[model samples]
Target: MADIVDTAVSAGSFTSLVAAVQAAGLVDTLKGPGPFTVFAPTDDAFAKLPAGTVEALFNDIPQLTKILTYHVVSGKVMAADVVKLTSAKTVEGSEVKIDASNGVKINDATVTAADVVADNGVIHVIDSVLLPA
Candidate 1:
């Protein structure tokens, strides 16, 4: 399997996310060693954002990084492990509410796909992009 960066690129469903990651200069970081748990939002999820939101974020690195990091947890938390928790702290130092009672939801997004293997970690595809509160 490819690393986080390459795996995301290959998925083809995370264009907006990929662009944001690149803009935040986090591609290399996410591609590095160890394990990471990424709640990856699909391009469709980004499209749900109000017009100009994505564009506006790219121009603001701090905001973009904050939003992107909200989608990531520090360790390789697979679906099974995540379901056992009521919440998980993200790398951004914020807690994401996890509701596994009805499928799996992280914040306001629902997990559409889970346990996607990557060289550096795992990917759980979400239907909505998570924003920091």
Candidate 2:
């Protein structure tokens, strides 16, 4: 199996996500031997941002990197493990709230697809982009 980056590439729904990761210079980290849990936001999710937010972020590498890194958490936490927690800290140093009362929610986003295995991590496709508090 390929890494998280490769998996997202294959799904073809995370175009903006891939670009953001590239912009953040996190491709190598996601490609490394890790067991990460990625709260992957689809391109559509990014569209939910305020108008021109994506463009502004793309223009600002540091801010974009921070937002992108907020989606990743160390360790490959699968769906089951997720339900046992109230929150999980991200690589970006922010904690994302988890709600399992109805399906699974990560902050304001819902996990549309979960437990997608990759060589380096697990990808949980979410419908909303997570922002740092």
Candidate 3:
């Protein structure tokens, strides 16, 4: 099985997300031996941001890294486990609210798909980009 980065690349819907991860210099980390749970945003989700938001993030590595890491949790928390929780602390050091009462929401983004298993972790597809306050 492929790692998170490879899995995301093969999925083909995470182009913007993959690029942002690379730009943030987090490719190795995501590819590492961690059992991460990533709330992945699709290209369409990234497009929902204001004009130039992505471009500006590319230039701001620190901010980009924060936002990217905010999508991840430390362990391989699958859909079943995620639904049982009210919140989860992200890799970015902030807690994201999980509202499974209504179709599973990670912060303001809805989980469109769940439990995409990768070698190193799991990916839950979300409809919007999650930002840390």
Candidate 4:
């Protein structure tokens, strides 16, 4: 199996996300071992941001890294595991609330697709970019 980066690239829906990850210098980290659970936002999700939001973040590496890392948790949390949790700590050092009452939400983003397996971790596609509070 391919790594998270490769899997996302192959999926073709994460073009913006992959670009942001590259810009944030997180390609290596996400491809590394130890099982990360990434709530990956799609290109459409990035588009949901304000007009200048994506452009602004692209130039701010530190803040960009924070936002990208906020989407990641340090475990291979699948859909079943995620549904059982109320919250999970992110790699960015903040906790994201998980609400399974409707479908499944991480912070304010809805989980659109789940259990996308990767060699090093798992990816759950989300519908919005999760901004840290």
lDDT of each: 0.93, 0.94, 0.97, 0.95
lDDT tens string, model 4, 46-118?
9999999999999999999999999999989999999999999999999999999999999889999999999
Index of the highest-lDDT prediction: 3
lDDT for each residue of candidate 1 in 19-81, tens digit (9 for 90 to 100): 999999999899999589999999999999999999999999999999999899988999989
- lDDT ranking of the models: 3, 4, 2, 1
Tens digit per residue, CA lDDT, model 3, 1-133: 9999999999999999999999999999999999999999999999999999999999999999999999999999999999999999999999999999989999899999999999999999999999999
Q: Worst ten-residue run, lDDT, model 1?
A: 27-36
Task: Please state the error at residue 19 of candidate 1 in Å.
Answer: 0.7
TM-score of each: 0.98, 0.98, 0.99, 0.98
Model 4 C-alpha lDDT versus the unseen true structure: 0.95
Steric overlap count per candidate: 0, 2, 0, 0
Best by TM-score: 3
Across 51-71, the per-residue lDDT of candidate 2 in tens digits comes to: 999999989999998998899
Higher-lDDT candidate of 2 and 4: 4
